[model samples]
Target: MTKMNHKILLGAAITLASLQQASAVPFAPSDARSMGMGGTGVSSAEVASTVQFNPALLATTREDDHFGLKIPQFSLSVADDGGFIDEAEDFDEESELDTTGQGRTNVDLLSDLLDEATGPLGLEKMQQGIEELKAAQLLPNSAPIAKKTAYDNAATKLTQASEFLDTRLYSRNPSVNGEAGLVVYSGAIADDMDDLNNKALRINGGLNVAGAVPSKKFSMAVHAGAQVTFSGKVKIDPKDTDILRNYSAATSAYLLNIDALQLALTNLDENDSSTFDAVDTAQQAVDNFNYGGAGRPESEGNTAIFVDGELSPEAEDADLDSEIQMIGVAVADVGVTASRVFNIKGHDIAFGITPKLQKISIFDYTQELDSEEEFDSEDFSENQEDYSAFNIDLGAAYQFGAEKQWQAGLVIKNLIGDDYESAEYISSNGVGGAVVSISPMMRAGISHRTSWTKVAFDLDITENDPVAFEDPTQYAAIGGELNVWRIVQLRAGYRANLAGSDQDIMTAGIGISPGPVHLDIGVMANTSDIENEAGIALEFGVEF
Candidate 1:
């Protein structure tokens, strides 16, 4: 695992350094009202939040809503359907290694086995015993019991060492899989590697403040807010799987040599010259046993333990090129909005415009697998690229019906599109960077209103491109609101992806407005997987 993966898994609640989504759908930064109604606000937004959806709504608001002040509003969303985040968080807890004493890992086990097999009391000691037996053969007067004892000791040590290798490195247990029923594999480290293959995670957050004055003749508002996103994915090297899985096969070959040498020892005969030649052959085999040299593996049994002499591929410090890529962005904007209602042939039409200044900061970071260094959130800010630009938004709304209860609205945001490049990183493969794209997006909405009930629907007319690394999105949403004598309100809605890239979302919310002061809260989650996809918004304000 990389340091960035750890930082995101452990410090997610305390830091905003990393977040990700499976799809690149754009998120709205409006108040709880729009969120509760399935993000449908273009045609039915209140005066204080009209600038966030369709500015024309500022002038077309209810006749009694003379003034609106939304001091603070906040929203957050996250998606991780891949289960990457959960796997990372549970890595330590779910590890199969022993935790009672030294907490030995697979690398530690291999190192111990290698040292025992090649150390002073290992092959060298066995060779010394063989030399003693050869001396016994040379001296015809030597006691047969002593010679036999020497042979037994040498053979016993070889047998014990072979058994040790089997227990420690070649053991297996039963396991069941959905696709492949009951089967046995090398087990621990290889299984863990398979679980971590290719997975992604995402997170988003926003905050805003605004104030507006509503009027049919002329309406005005000021809005300011910021939206931040963090996301990443893991990319495992294919070589790691081969290295971990082939250990059993290599060790089995070594065990076979041990068995053959033992048979030659058991058939030893001092009187038979042919037997002498067999013993010599077995001794030669035992003495010439060799384990392959390490660096990068060239074949089976040649797992790369050390890379460039200092770092081990199995250790946390080894750099095996890029294994994970992450991106973070913050977009802040302040805007002044103006709108007016016009009357033509007994019909009411509203038009509005907003001009805003935007500051965008983006961070692109990458890290190799098995890295131990801690990832700092400040790195995102320190290495980010900053860009400043001016943008415009236009909106229009028309009201009709016998009691003027029907309304239709259209909004075009970010008329002047711009693209900014983020920081870059170089690896053995190539250079990589993130592009923060601002593009024009249009949405159309329609609504029907009564004294106590209002229903609205909205549809995206253009597909919006991702700002970082996500999928393009177009949405169709429907929502309804119920007012309880202007005191309490309940809202429910649903949103569907027209592009068929993401899951459908269900939304619900509540509002309290006894007099001039109001408080609202809204929440949303995908219909299928609530744990990986969810959102919440909250706001406090005054309206009349």
Candidate 2:
């Protein structure tokens, strides 16, 4: 196929541009405080973030808190353990330059050689001269000395041509293979395509605003937020690999046929009574030289030179069947939480519930990797599906210890599970359908708290399915916060994926509270392979 510049950001930006509503679908904690503490807010959340963590926190938090407000809490994360981004960037970089240490890009070299081989003064003319020599009539009993001279001339020229091919095309120069860029030989393009197959890039982000009024007797909170998630993957067609690989093989085969004909003419016996028969034998070798059996093997079918003894343009013009499939989900939710504490068996227990309305939009866009099609805002919107639904969250927390410093909590979000179908997009199989399911998410946590120090741990009891085409996640996390005289707080934690499909992360954050206004910043990175995963969150709020 024709070479085209592949700047992968065209696909990346489409997913990132929808960050306004990419949340809640992953159903993971996104607030700065929670994220800093390794997504462990189930039991340790303060009244300010009770709506996002555990609503029961509204009643279970420190008795000194009365009111809390959080406006514009934001967080974003990306994972690319497959090295898809790196590969794309490298390919783009290589495509921009010319004449590396290898003399020229492999494709350019092959293309130019192909043009010359099929030119007016190339292999075809040489072959015609041989045919004319074969067709010359021999006089009765005359020695075919003139015919032998012509044959020798053709053979000598063919030997020179064969040596040129060997030096320029066949010989692997030390510098050529040492270069970093691709050497588009027989299987190089196919190997590159295989490397990209199934590699995925995922991005998720959310923005939220919330307010809460806390009390042991009764508590209430209101939260409105939006989150967006995008996932993109490479889908390669096997036919694309075969076509490209076969084209490269054909070029080599074309050169091989020239050598075969040269050898046949060199061994011909022109002075024999069967001189015509010997010339006929060499002519047959040239005409029937299909150039198979080695390198590519005879069992793999014909790898002959293309149309009418020339490299065919169809090989370069054919459409690549491979495509980059992208899916994005934007969800917005508005919810209200109510919580209360009750004295049961001489101990205080808190319970909370939230009923929420959700608006979800799904975008499914698929395009061939080599396509020149452009996508704009309207095009993206056209590929989206929107839906509205209602959901509920239930939470409970209990405190038991000498001074009630030990607390345990449980939360079940999206109590009534539902599935939303995505907008139709042409799939690789020619069908058009996908489903995003919102299932009940159950998590349990425990925390031990003292005036200035707190440690908490949480575990997801249920695995959350991917909203698009990513791995399902179930996280178990441990985190702690140190409050320095209530002015500045330092937090750190580690989160591990119980499902074992994603990277484990280490998180840290700083929260500065001057008087009642607070600012929180949290950052996280994959414990291993740092470049593959990272996230950051920021939130500003006030609490009393």
Candidate 3:
């Protein structure tokens, strides 16, 4: 009834409706080179593109005039079912009674009879309706005209019940029935009401950056990224049929109370009416039906029936759209290494490690109604901060036999402590820790010193522990590559998930090299789910 109670109810309603926000999950890139095949470059000197894979690899940069760029696209979707109510149904029936033939009923007698029927059970039900109406901001004090209109509508239904119940039940039970009849009638009435509501949402965003390594062993770079998310849903859809049923039950209770009161009034006489006070008592009973506040007041009017009235679908939808953006900076190896021999035996190795700092920003806003048309600001702000952590990677490769026909390599990624702490969100403390990959590779089928073509195969084993972050899994990829005219290379591979969702990744890529510049593009496609996902990546590098 007080302003404080009104605000509390409204806040509770908003909390209950805002439960559909979306959360972000971890992601992985499917490109073989990014996955650590030959180590991301034509040679072992640090290049701009390598910074994205392993920062430690940047330490091996031997070239001063080299630069590279990379662009990638990724997407995912999830399907959810079973949870919360979706629909509501309600119905009402009415008839008129000729109370004119009967002597004037004492309103006092009627009030006593109706009170007996409701007792504690009816009062509890009425209180619940009031609570819901208050939460919706539909209380008489908040929306006076709308509140009054709903109250009158409910009262009119009660008036109609006076005629219907008087005609039907008056002849059957002229005396008081036991509490058993009251309970049965009350329950039956509650079952006819209906109420329904529905909701849904969508989110999207992206990141971008530019930087360079100033020297061979030590290099510095700068990066920037942004994210945008939006969500919205509509009610009154066919899915929300349950809401209607609740309404029908509430209306039925109102009518039943009126009928019971009319019967009691009929039992009182005129002389008793002056002293009996049945009509006055009945009026009080009707006023008590206003469940809008803590205690019944004449000014409150009938608030029970309108308690579950319609809500503004648009206003509700906007409230759900707000979410935070996640931004971060990552450092990795960007150098290149070159082979010294053409055949018999050759060796080259490059390593990189990346330490990252991230910031997550979430914005929340609430709406308050003042005089319907006017509004006032509560508290709103854009707060930005950061989270810091580190991850490391080591990569190496060896070539054997004439024409460097055989090659083998090993890579260790995220090889550090698992937990990362930031201002907005704490990454799982269990340590993103480490992932190990071993690639036993081979190249053959070359004729002579002037041969223009060659073929190669790489078998890899990767241990990905998304689990520390609550997602854990292992994967393997078997792939082969072909070179033509010493200018173009084609690659294809099959990858398999060893833990969690058992799915296969089919991948392919192409590489082009002209003089000192090299370009590589790769595509990975998931074939398991109906809404399959495909990932594409591009990498550029130059050899000095």
Instruction: Score each candidate by Cα lDDT.
Output: 0.68, 0.71, 0.34
| Global lDDT of model 1 | 0.68
Q: Which stretches of candidate 2 lie over 4 Å from their true place?
A: 1-24, 95-189, 242-246, 262-318, 374-378, 425-433, 468-470
TM-scores for all candidates? 0.76, 0.79, 0.42
Clashes by residue pair, model 2: 21-227, 21-228, 22-227, 22-228, 22-229, 23-227, 23-228
Q: lDDT: which is higher, 1 or 3?
A: 1
Output the lDDT of residue 159, model 3: 44
Question: Could you tell me which residue pairs clash in candidate 1?
Answer: 19-203, 19-230, 19-231, 20-201, 20-202, 20-203, 21-202, 24-471
Clashes of each: 8, 7, 68
In terms of TM-score, the best-performing candidate is: 2
Question: Could you give candidate 3's per-residue lDDT for residues 1-544 as a string of tens digits?
Answer: 1000111111211211212122221223223343222222312212454343333334334344444433332222221111111211111112011135443222222223344423433433444433432332334344545544444444344444444333322323335532222223322322311121222222223333334453433445433333333222222221112212222233344545555444434443433424124434554454454222225343332222223222223211212222112222122222232212112233343333344443433322223211122222222232222334333344443444575444444444444534322222323232321121111121111111114433333332433332111123345445555657647867666655555453556667777878656666666665564223345555554443
Q: Worst ten-residue run, lDDT, model 3?
A: 1-10
Better of 1 and 2 by lDDT: 2
Q: What is the lDDT of residue 185 in candidate 1?
A: 27
